[model samples]
Target chain A: MQDREKAFIRALVRSNATFGIGDDGVEISNFVVANDAFFEDVHFKRAWGSLESIVEKCFVVNLSDIYAMNAIPRFCLLMLTLPTDFKEVGKLAKIIGNCALKHKVKIIGGDTIAGDKLHFSLTFLGQRQKSRILTRQSIKKGDILGYMNPSSVLTHTKTQAFGKNTKILKTALRFHQHRKIQSNTRFAKPILYPKMLLELNSIARAGMDISDGIFMELPRLSHLNRLGFKVFKPKGDWLYAPEEYQMLYAIPKNKLKKMQNFAKKHRHSFVPFAKAVRGKYRESKKNWHT
Target chain B: MQDREKAFIRALVRSNATFGIGDDGVEISNFVVANDAFFEDVHFKRAWGSLESIVEKCFVVNLSDIYAMNAIPRFCLLMLTLPTDFKEVGKLAKIIGNCALKHKVKIIGGDTIAGDKLHFSLTFLGQRQKSRILTRQSIKKGDILGYMNPSSVLTHTKTQAFGKNTKILKTALRFHQHRKIQSNTRFAKPILYPKMLLELNSIARAGMDISDGIFMELPRLSHLNRLGFKVFKPKGDWLYAPEEYQMLYAIPKNKLKKMQNFAKKHRHSFVPFAKAVRGKYRESKKNWHT
Candidate 1:
């Protein structure tokens, strides 16, 4: 395509396409869930990543959502945009099915669309006990912030933090760990991340998955409590981003030891990012006296 | 486009672009309602349709759905594949949002691509009283089949049924009886064939809004029941094709009179479609009538 043609396509992508879907306007269950993710060229590009990694990364990104609500996902509705090169639909299905099954989730429903790039969306629903439900508006002042992840958190979502480190936006491709999936889509074991379910119950004051970034996310969590956070220590291969959608929760001070112990039992990582303090958002940021 | 390109685009439109969402997916409280309509060359001047109509029609079709479901529609996700002239993003959103706001729906989400002819897929979601909802599954076998609109009844969404009716589809271009708005999107509502909300909880038997021919729809309801039907007479614009989804449900045998009385109170067009019989689906066909 020529300059004008490429510009036309770029404009088409940026200014919403010929189709538009309504946002969250319907009544849903307390823990209702919906997720969407994109892969290369259209959203990112394979020239910088591999398809298997792309698929695995997609799973983690969406699963980050179930972790956010602290709900166990039951079913997922997938909307997949297939590129012309992907002729083996059956193989792709098995790839997705195996990945989801290992997480104790199912690919019960989804859609497939053929497009220039690989993009997929999942509209899934899961349940949370009515009393244990988490929402953005639930954090209270004096609550403590908890960040969980096995190691580094990398996700191919529109996160803001890792962009400065990797110099890429909208994807967390570990070009350093690239490998080819043979013509056959087979993998020996499941690709697992900071497995953080079964550890969050009554402990979290409020929480959200950090698809955006730990940098932008901590501030968001702190705002919930009419508070500010002093993120004391930033650990792990922080610069090595993978699909790190570990849980970020605001827990009461009293529950710290208990939540950490619970994390230990499940072999999940847990860390204290900052404390919820009462103050203006900017004041807290400036005085984030870690 | 070459023959291969045209054929490829056609397949994509049917299977992917407008992948019948609600019927095939993991069922939720249908957040995104759907409506798909097709008109040949006459629906618009050959070149005028563009990708915009693909977006607009999905909104239009689903606006009727939001009404049918007794919900205030809020958002729509559209999918469209167009021929060469489909690049005007601003123009597309202009028409879509105009039609959407009339129903108070917004243009929050979107997707698009290229194709030979114009095909539109609109998925919309809205909010309504959980208790006062409507669906064909709730209709009883003996309940009455009422024509809410004395105006029109084109029950098929099939191409052939829609193909023979350009004269009726042309009515869309003329100013409709519905209110006209100054927002760039004007309207001649497609002779909206609406069902009454008040009729939902009434004594009506299993009901469906008529989509495919009453001939096609009633039998499906029969299959749902151990009952069969004997339609002595059919109602509405029989010459016209089915206009999107317009199915109503069957009346329970015991409550037919009460349903009739209820229909009368609400001013519903409850014509007795057919009487239930214990027969095979083939026998229910108009030609196979006893």
Candidate 2:
């Protein structure tokens, strides 16, 4: 989180109104409500891709939160702001409706208005897992932190396409000229593993979708779990690459073998890079989200 | 609704994903979920009021939907976008938290980001009434359409405060100079009647919050109920005034006396201005909402 957002949320924490403010999505009885905003120039630009692809990424980002919690998304409400002269209103509605139908989520209701920039704020209602809801607070002091990454071939291609440790803004600008951005590029149709997340629900102690990169999410998990992390050097550009939409999980020492086996069978890499310890841990670098 | 929005929603009506798109809020089992977007230059301007008052209006507008459905609001999730250089982040959070607390709504999780303009998209989860859920589709032919208005004193003052049928944009600019807009002014802390709405829940057959003025809303009711309205010539500036946040209800002819008595007891005027008929009714004026 950005410092300003963190400070703002700290003040909100003082009020009784804040009940489930720190999780991926707040659990309300059998449902989980998650919301995310995608604003023009801040999150994406029209030059980056087609409107269909842009809309798809917005839906995928919100769906990641639901799947990370082992929940099935059921309903969707969209608050869309379009430029006054922007045509293709019907196409926008078609894309949104088709995406909801593809996910089996009902488009219940929302409000749309005209504005200077395009903005979409989507609220997703997901049916919670019947037995348990995975959250970030359940990690233990000795839990091992692992993250789901794409296959080795895709990772190698991504590394070559964007170069190691290159900021996303530069890559997005470079790829925009080609007009053929590979799906492996960050923020281009993020890959989510729902089935693996469901399997890990029985083994992992806690988990969340990594949108703000591992460098930023680790401190949040550390604060929530009241434990520090014994960090290990990551092999590639995965540490600070934002918008992965992949799951970061904390697995107990005993269930480590089972989790590894599940990831291997699913053909996904689960790279363990940290272990929870006694002291606090903070990222030295500033957040790129702001 | 604007012409573009009407066309956009008409296309969405084709998909099975759209279940309850024509109501104040979508009823999902026991909960009613409503979402609305407030954007700078579109909904409100920073120069029009203090930040606290602007934020309060955002919450009140969403709450109006919940009360219009006769549901009790339970939770709120906010997607807020602030300018990069804007300060007072903590103050914004406090006002939001306090507003939720005052309304007895829990502040759940949401997303916040920095952008070029201020934007807020609020989602409210409300518990549906146990006995029934009020909707716009239940109005029957021969039903008398009534609206809840402020008492005579406030109405008279409001009539003189902003001249009858004056455009809101010009009035807002003129009022912005004085910096002392009355609470009765449109979009300036709208007055809601929850107790009276609950009382009318049993007497009125259909109801909805009038956000896009009575002229625009009446056609929506006509389209939903497949009946026309014999609209009375309104006495004052009420018909074309947008952002009133008042309730427009459809009551049976036999229950008009009971509804009036209840409104009198509550010190609100129930103005019966229309009756459902077989012929269609269309407002000639273009929608001011766009």
Candidate 3:
């Protein structure tokens, strides 16, 4: 780093403000709750992404986990790795605070480190009702798989970052500009729907958000119970490309209809994708997504 | 990535194992963690610093955080960027796991990504006591500053990479290598002292372990509480030299003498750094590692 940059960083460190860039790492507490997001470049970018959208995107990424577990996020630890002279630190922080307020989450303890690329990882601690908790390993075979939020966040980014150096900022801007020109923007609504997950009660059987390659997540969850899954994902391009934060739940076949009703009540897209099976992938049909 | 390397990645992914590296990115869960480390080339050369020591060094650097937070760390996430695969990753992972088990921690999650230089990071998480949380913001002025482990983790890695690199592997078998090395090896012990923290119950006003620079952290904790810190960090290079981990707490002055009793019980060190001040840097203290 040049002398000037070093000086800038030192000032950021000495700002005596909430958070800043520092060579000396964070002064954190113990028995703490934190979460970090290792965002793929296209998942968040600044160029055209409105500061609010970028901020909103970050909240969506993390709260997805909180929702999947049917928990209420109490505090968040935001760890950011961005380029020197990070263009939007202050704005992003503000947006995060606002979103947290909307969701009743607090920005308690976290750090911001400098990296060559933009990787925003936020660790959040949620308050679960002890026994009312859910985990991937607890999933059972033959449980009906009830999926929600048909237009997952994955579909959004895949469309925006189909090629080139796609990043969070560019993808966000793509949505923003599209909304501005069309004079209609429903992005925020879908993004906020995950917050309703806390009300899922006990219906969300073995559950997980469609992060990573959803294709990969399915078989992995099934394996936890030595079972296979027969998924009937929507037969469209949307099934393949997604930024959609789709919730994959393993409810029993008898409860699938009830779960769909719950989704309609909350107005989330409830799409039944697969059924938990009792065989290996080789023995089952593999023609889906192909 | 060539075809074979791509296949290697595919197989790692197909295993449905956590922490695989691919286009889909790392897939470790919340129970998993990884951290990053950026070091000066002169900081540790391959000649004097055995690959085992480097591996141990990286583990201490991050494992310290896991212990500091009073979390039961189950795994370690590693990403080391070096000129070549000069170090055996399996050996590194095993050594880290051994260290974790010694400390009652675990090595359940990790992701390794190559980089242009010898920069590495680990993002790991541990289970913290859900309650009895600690944070830097809780420190008020006039609190006692205590040192759990006053030592530093400094070693010579200067002649290694520049000289007969990794020649230690070819040297006549060293007899001492078989001895059970101390977990408190000067370079590793400073960071692994979780026992001291377990003693810090309800008394600590504000605290954070010194990893960056203790002097740097004093001001940080001060800033976090919107207060000023008065610290007597020794008067020389000790302030800037990289420290593995050292406790820096501001407890109530009334508890100052209690630390001595605690010290006797634990054989720990107690350093009476300056009082928690209410203003900016003192004019007389310009040697603040600035």
* Cα displacement (Å) at residue B88, model 3: 5.7
Query: Which candidate gets the maximum lDDT versus the true structure?
Result: 2
List the global CA lDDT of all models.
0.46, 0.79, 0.47
Give fnat (model 2): 0.80
Give the lDDT ranking, best first.
Answer: 2, 3, 1
- Per-residue alpha-carbon lDDT of model 3 for A1-290, expressed as tens digits? 12222232233223222121110111122112224344433343344345566666677756776666666565554445545555554545455556777777655433344556555555555666544555564556677665565333433332322111123323455564344221112232225455456655477666766544355455556555677777676544334433445566777678777777887677555667677778754222222110
Ranking by TM-score: 2, 3, 1
Q: How does candidate 2 score on lDDT?
A: 0.79
DockQ score of each predicted structure, in the order shown: 0.10, 0.72, 0.04
Q: Write the per-residue lDDT of candidate 2 for residues A86-110, one digit (tens) a residue.
A: 8888888888788889878898888
**Which regions in candidate 2 have their CA more than 4 angstroms from the true location?**
A152-169, A173-180, A184-186, A233-236, B152-170, B173-180, B183-186, B233-236
> What residue runs in model 3 are displaced by over 4 Å at the alpha carbon?
A1-36, A40-42, A137-141, A149-190, A199-201, A231-235, A282-290, B1-96, B106-191, B200-207, B220-234, B237-244, B249-269, B273-280, B283-290
Native contact recovery (fnat) for each candidate is 0.05, 0.80, 0.00
TM-score of 2: 0.93
The B-chain TM-score of model 3 reads 0.64
lDDT tens digits by residue: candidate 1, B62-171: 56655555555665544443446545645554555556555566444333444444434444555554545545454433444543333223322222222223334444
